[model samples]
Target: MSTDRTDCLFCRIVAGDVPATVVATTDRAVAFRDIDPRAPLHVLVVPREHHPDVVALAAADPALLADVVALGRQVAEAEAGGQFRLVFNTGPEAGQSVEHVHGHVLGGTRLGWSPG
Candidate 1:
């Protein structure tokens, strides 16, 4: 795959340049344990390619976006008790610390509506 960005953290993880506790991987997406997990089953699912956020990724590659969601679902089904929430924070203000597009699979507890 042609991972474009060198500075993107998720891209680095996908390229095997950075170390992460990877739990799942597909041709277009990867899932790993979050460093600071909010839920008991908090995993981060990211695309191999670099996109600023989910909206950018969806615009750039809708198929890859589908792969990301599927990968998240696969991980959540195996790890979380079949009931999980998928979250995509678009910007830093929205809690997206990394620039690369990613989704968070959260479960193993009751999730609040506010998403704090």
Candidate 2:
């Protein structure tokens, strides 16, 4: 929100200061493989601009949120045969580790239903 959070890890990744296994990228977003994958096809789609969480992103830029989702779909299609789950963890209790808003693309196998 403040232009770019210099200390945010994803911002560093976007700025090319941090190394990441980027899979797909657009002018508004970037898609990269998750280091600790919960699924076979685990990738993260994040906007180029920094936002604290998905709600902030959506409120500030709905179109960018759509772009992030669109990119997630593209990643799922290419890596998971067009079937996937897109997850947005909004807070620490919700499993959001990074401050930057991102959508996790999970697939490549039948996912179990375990929300807890």
Candidate 3:
């Protein structure tokens, strides 16, 4: 997978080329608030390095993938009382709008199961 894509939105955010409501960061990951939040606590945890999707990230760097998830949990604990749902949308059909691999941390309220 590519390291950085100049045209990628998340890459721009990571590079400080674009502004984001950053919640947290680590050597391996960055967590920021989602523009269109689906929940009160809607943060996205992304690896500092670029990877097309979560599967690519898992295959190329499992540790980085774990780092992303760990950051997501950290954000959840701080923002959502330690309970959250981590979602990785792999493709367009799966609701992945950006190419960069990210884990959506959703919580802050009682969640409902309506994946339609």
How far off is model 1, as Cα RMSD?
1.6
Name the lDDT value of residue 44 in candidate 1.
Answer: 95
Weakest 10 consecutive residues, lDDT, candidate 2?
A: 1-10
Q: Looking at candidate 2, what is the lDDT of residue 83?
A: 97
Say which prediction, candidate 1 or candidate 2, comes out ahead on TM-score. 2
**36-69 in candidate 2: lDDT tens per residue?**
9999999999999999999999999999999999
Model 3 lDDT on a 0 to 1 scale:
0.92
Q: What C-alpha lDDT does candidate 1 achieve relative to the native structure?
A: 0.89
| lDDT by residue (tens digit), candidate 3, 1-116 | 56478999998999899999998999889999999999999999999899999999999999999999999999999988999999999999989999899999999999999876
Collision count for each candidate, in order: 0, 0, 0
| RMSD to true structure for each model, in Å | 1.6, 0.9, 0.9
Candidate 3 lowest-lDDT run of ten: 1-10
State the displacement of the C-alpha of residue 36, model 3, in Å, after optimal TM-score superposition. Answer: 0.5
Model 2 global lDDT (CA atoms, 0 to 1): 0.94
lDDT of 1 by residue, 4-33 (tens): 678788888888999999999987789999
